[model samples]
Target chain A: MLDRDEDILKAAESWAEVDKGVALATVIETWGSAPRPAGSNLVVNEDGTFLGSVSGGCVEGAVVTEALDVISSGAPRMLEFGVADETAWTVGLSCGGRIRVFVEKVV
Target chain B: MKLATLSAINTERAARRPVIVVTDIGNGEQRLVRAADIARDPLHIELERHLRMGKSSVIEVEGRELFLNVYAPTAKLVIIGAVHISQALAPLARSLGYDVTVVDPRSAFASPERFPDVRLIAEWPDVALPPLNIDHYTAFVAVTHDPKIDDPALLHALERDCFYIGALGSRNTHGQRAVRLRAEGVSEASIERIHAPIGLEIGAISPSEIAVAIMAEITAQLRLPKASTA
Candidate 1:
């Protein structure tokens, strides 16, 4: 009965158990025309491998980049992206919506 | 956040008990709260509200953002007949993420070939329902068209807190069914909960269309607020 989110967390745990640095990103909030809903999760491994999604490919690359940093520094980071922001065009979230993703290293 | 906490959460989820994972985003501190422990938790009120709706949310508590990930057991659809509608409804419900179980005492109707990949119980309503563990997350549909079978199934569904109880029949047939239920001493409020005719008024003719209407009505009941008829 493990749902998709639980499976993502389990995957993160397994990755960490094998000495692969793992970071978990979760969608805390979304506004306007966001593709994914809140509470969606994405887990990243140290080798740049990942599972699940936060924004349905809208800002996953940016989140994964931040996740690698979180995995290295062991510090959590909250990322915001939207068409209203200047970074949105670069991050590819220009789909006309805002989303807040929290990335943390799984310890 | 400890790995043991995640393991505990998965254990509770496997057991089909509702659980909420409360995580502090600032410090990465996480705790697993079982449904029974919600009453003792500091965020009991918010946890209860989210649990009832079976949704997850992120809330700010005293300037610290905490994500409440609510994990309830998968909803179930207990159909009490193996008719054509059940054939369509089983896969439809499964596609909609419901754990479906088709119950009928007739072994020929509840055959494995008919309900492949679906759970089938060839037992009478009185014998099968109690073990099915029907709860508030369950949607019960009695479409047997036999009073002896459908009546007991409806009674069991009413006694439990099933979110939806639908019975298949025409208006006149339902009227007669109601009189019989009243004679059996079912409460007026409980009787009112039964959705006779079993589906939305979409003028559905085929079995699949009727299944669509039934699923739509059940979704409406599960997601929408009750309207005032007055």
Candidate 2:
């Protein structure tokens, strides 16, 4: 967790230093067969560039889209995706698990 | 998510201090909390529990959900022998995310060429262990059969709070070691903590297999319940 998550934080610092809009998405909770465990992070820039992962590859696109909005709005968003949810197919979390990711602009 | 807080987290991590980045999901507010500061923090009790376990987790405090991004110092493996088993053990421990240090007074065995990319301290255990600052996250393994070398290292490891202390020897040798330690005024309880015939009984014969067994035992000691290990 430290090794990879540290990389994410370091990347965020670098991006922020360059004046790029930045947001951080963190997997706050997971239930049953979640690919990545809770506390996994995905750091995103306004340009759609990112580092790290909250879910292996499943929910990253949706998280990034929300993160872009978060960067513009300066508001945090909590997103829940799972196979049981209606948007599961849309978000591609067909792995039979639930994950709650919180995205917030880095201040 | 302040840059100052992120910088503080990096600084604390570089210093090998246990830290937690507590993020309030609702408000997007975050603060860096070091292990030293956890006691005075409002979430002291909860923070300390996660700190000891060395795991990042989420918890609720007064109806607010907070993410605790724990950053404990990487666990350390301090090998006392620099022998064949140490060769295997160092890399294995490194792969398991432990910062490994190989200690041996013998320059021939503790050469950089022999253990490339690994920290080597070519000093006797009594002279070497003090500076290493052995702590709870450390796993101390005495692979050198020589009592002169292994005993002092064991004494130092026991005195400190090393989570695992394993000595490579037969049961007979460990019995003799027990007598020697007792004579040296080391307590029975402290002596009992030593995992003699180190490693799980996986019938390991070669050095690599022995290293695997030792690592497995250390992992069990690290992750399992005390009653289960007992």
Candidate 3:
């Protein structure tokens, strides 16, 4: 229950050091029965290899896709997903909770 | 985040020290705060509170939104006895994601047959504790109720500055323990820190209930504000 590991963050650093584009997506906020807590991270490399979870599996694919864009542009973006959002059907949290993720590239 | 900042955080985590990354979500600016540097940081109050809670939180200051992502070491439980209480306490702690270790000098008590899938050290506290590296993240419990075993283990725990130090004993038993510890050069303040009547005042009569009480007290010690004790 309490096995929180920072291995993903470590992987993010090592990938960036090897000159690979790395993007980190963190759950900055959560509301009403979120699967993951705020500050949960998902690290994505240039090849879309990802570690960790911001919204369990419900929104990781979407976050990884956005992370690739952030890695290329070096611009951070905030993505929100939930039943209440317009993109909910596409990448909404199936757990019925809303989460705001902050996606940023490692420089 | 900068590569240097990320590397610094990984370094601190490798050493098992608490660190926080304060991020400015508005502009994506971020800075790393090591445990040793938190007291001097501009947001020391917020950072210390979040670290004590072992949680990450978002706060607003000066019209800016900041997310504090705390990376604290996993809490460890060092049980100095392999008795009934330890048997119950070990599994409970493990379920809570704590690194639980039971140390008893007696082979019969520390047998793997009795306590399965747990780290059982059949060695004296002096030999067992040093290598365990008990620190502020550890909760040390002396439940052997034997002065020969519990006293030295508690002394080592005190020296290590464990976040929680508890012993399974009544007020009368603890009074005598205090005298013995004082004679051995432990200060009055340090002795006072030990929870003599260990666990919450829940009138726990069974080993399982006592384990729950102890875990509850540890949870309070970990998550509650340092100033709030009752």
Candidate lDDT values, in order: 0.86, 0.88, 0.91
Count of clashing residue pairs in every prediction = 0, 0, 0
Interface RMSD of 1: 2.7
Clashes of 3: 0
Poorest 10 consecutive residues of model 3 chain B by lDDT? Answer: B221-230
Compose the digit string of candidate 2's lDDT tens values, residues A1-107. 45777778888988887889999888888889989877678999999999999889998988999999999998889999998878887886767899998888877
- On a 0 to 1 TM-score scale, where does candidate 1 land against the true structure? 0.75
Interface RMSD per candidate: 2.7, 2.0, 2.0
Task: Tell me the TM-score of each prediction against the true structure.
Answer: 0.75, 0.76, 0.96
Top candidate by lDDT: 3
Root-mean-square deviation (CA) per prediction? 4.2, 4.1, 1.6
* CA error at residue B188 for candidate 1, angstroms: 9.4
On a 0 to 1 TM-score scale, where does candidate 3 land against the true structure? 0.96
Instruction: Candidate 1: list runs displaced more than 4 Å.
Output: A17-20, B87-96, B103-136, B147-162, B170-213, B224-230
Native interface contact recovery, all models: 0.44, 0.46, 0.72
Q: In candidate 1, what are the lDDT values of residues B1-230, reduced to their tens digit?
A: 56577667667866778888888887878888998899989899889878877777789999998898788878899999998999999999999889999999999999989999999999999999999989878999999899998999998899998889999999999999999999999998988999988899899999999999999989888766446210
Per-residue accuracy of model 3 over B1-230 as CA lDDT, tens digit each: 89998898788887789889999999998989999999999899999999988788789999999999998888899999999999999999999889999999999999998899999999999999999999889999999999999999999998987889999999999999999999999999999889979999898999999999999999998889878974
lDDT of 3 by residue, A1-107 (tens): 22345788899999999999999898888899999888788999999899899887998888999999999999999999999878888878877999999999999
